[model samples]
Each structure stands twice: as structure tokens, then as C-alpha cells.
Target: MKFAPERSSVALFVALTRAVREAPVAEGGRSLAYDVIDRLAKVINTPGFKVELEALIALGAREPVLNSALEPFWQELHMLSSSSSAGSA
Candidate 1:
């Protein structure tokens, strides 16, 4: 079943958050959390998910790990957006 972008993002965020929170801290909890948040930011930043993405980003999440996790997602998001835009015209 296909999920609406917002719903899919939310689900992904929840799963990532859970994984980060439950993982052993000794294994780098802070960094893990940051990565999860970063990925969440990308998921939310998708074309139809911008508003949610902005809200999530505004929640005071700034960490190097999170930024790193988000790097891949950001690249994917850009590619997706560009491809969709091109397809539209």
C-alpha cells in the first residue's frame, strides 16, 4: 500500500526515534539520535512534506551526527524533487 508522504515520513521518524532511543548509549546515543533526527528532517523536507519538515527542524535539533545522517537523505530528497519537477513539465 502506498502511503501519503506525510504519513510515511511520520512513521519513519517514529521508527528512527525509537531505534535511537532504545539503542545502548555506550554505542553513541547522542550521535545516533542526531542521525535519526537528520534523516527525519530529510523525510519531512520532501516536496509534500515541507511544512512538517520545517516544524521538526525548528524543534532545536543540532548535532553533528544528526547532520551526517541527514546528508544522505538531503541528497536523495534533492534528486527526488528535481526528478519530479522535470517529469512535470
Candidate 2:
């Protein structure tokens, strides 16, 4: 399996923060759900990224702020999981 370039946890945090912050759920702006799912969709197909994303979600859920940020993406994550599993079968 091919490995992606190593990224620090801090870098991942910063990227997610930027993504979430840029997506304002207000008039004239896209919803948080759309932005979060879009961010995950871009990486979900990359080798090892899905697993890391799941783990990150689990860890993030322990924190209230992170959990709120992640809430909108849960349904999209489930759909991605189902489609990927079917594709692999």
C-alpha cells in the first residue's frame, strides 16, 4: 500500500480548523455539513486516510467543540463507508 506524506497532528488540526472556520452556516455561505463532507470526500479514497479519519472522529467526539464540528459530517461518513464497502466486495 502506498503511504501519504507524514503530517503532524498539529497540521491536521490546523487544516480541519481552517476548513470548519471557512464554512459559515449563515446566509450567503455554504452550510457546515457541505463543507465538512466535502473536506472528508476529498481524502476518503486515499489509502489509509479513511481509517485515520474514523479514528480522528472518535477522538474528536470526546471533546464538545470538536464533536459539534463533526456532527454534520456523520451521515455523510456513513454513506461513504457503505459505498466503499460495497465497492470492495
Candidate 3:
């Protein structure tokens, strides 16, 4: 079944967050959460997914009052995805 980009993207993010929260954390949970988030993102295996999420991350960063602890995760996602896309092309 084909899904709208926005719907698929939002569902991916929601799944990522749920996976991150349920993940085991031995130390700083934020970093562990980031790792889980990164893994979850990679599972999508589509550059469009990364681009959509990256846009959301950028938007969130612009919100001064929105404390989105996703900078590191977003950066890692960007690097992995962009590099993979380049390699594929």
C-alpha cells in the first residue's frame, strides 16, 4: 500500500520516539535515545524519509521554546543518509 509522504514520515518519527523511549539506558538516556533514533531512521532505508525528518529537526531547532533534544540524532541521521545516498548515486 502506498502511503502519503507526510503520513509515512510522521509515522516513522512516532515509531522512532516510541522505540527510543522503550530502549534500555545505562547512562545518559539522551545519547542512547539518539542512537535508537538513528537506528530507527536507518530502518526506513529511504533518503526521502531522512530529508523529511531533517526538515522537522531544523524547524524544531528554530523554535526557541521547543526544547527538542534531537540535534545529535538529527546530525547523525543526516550524515549517514547523505553519505549513503551519495554512495548509491
Q: Clash totals for all models, in order?
A: 1, 0, 0
Q: By summed lDDT, which 10 consecutive residues of candidate 3 come out lowest?
A: 63-72
Whole-model lDDT values for every prediction: 0.48, 0.52, 0.51
Positional deviation of residue 86's Cα in model 1 after best superposition, in angstroms: 8.4
- Model 2: how far residue 5 lies from native, Å: 33
- Indicate the worst ten consecutive residues by lDDT in candidate 2: 24-33
| Pick by lDDT: 1 or 2, better one | 2
Model 3 residue 61 CA deviation in Å: 3.1
Model 1 lDDT per residue over 31-51, tens place: 545553665456543454444
**Least accurate 10 contiguous residues by lDDT in model 1:** 51-60
For model 3, name the residue pairs that clash: none
Candidate 2 lands at a TM-score of 0.45
Runs in model 3 deviating more than 4 A are: 1-43, 65-68
lDDT of 2 by residue, 1-89 (tens): 66446554355445555655654334223244344445555655454446656665754554445556656555555555565556655
TM-score for candidate 3, please give it: 0.38
* RMSD after Cα superposition, model 3: 12.2
The TM-score, computed over Cα atoms with residue i paired to residue i, of candidate 1 is 0.33
Off by over 4 Å in 1: 1-7, 35-39, 46-89
Whose TM-score is greatest here? 2
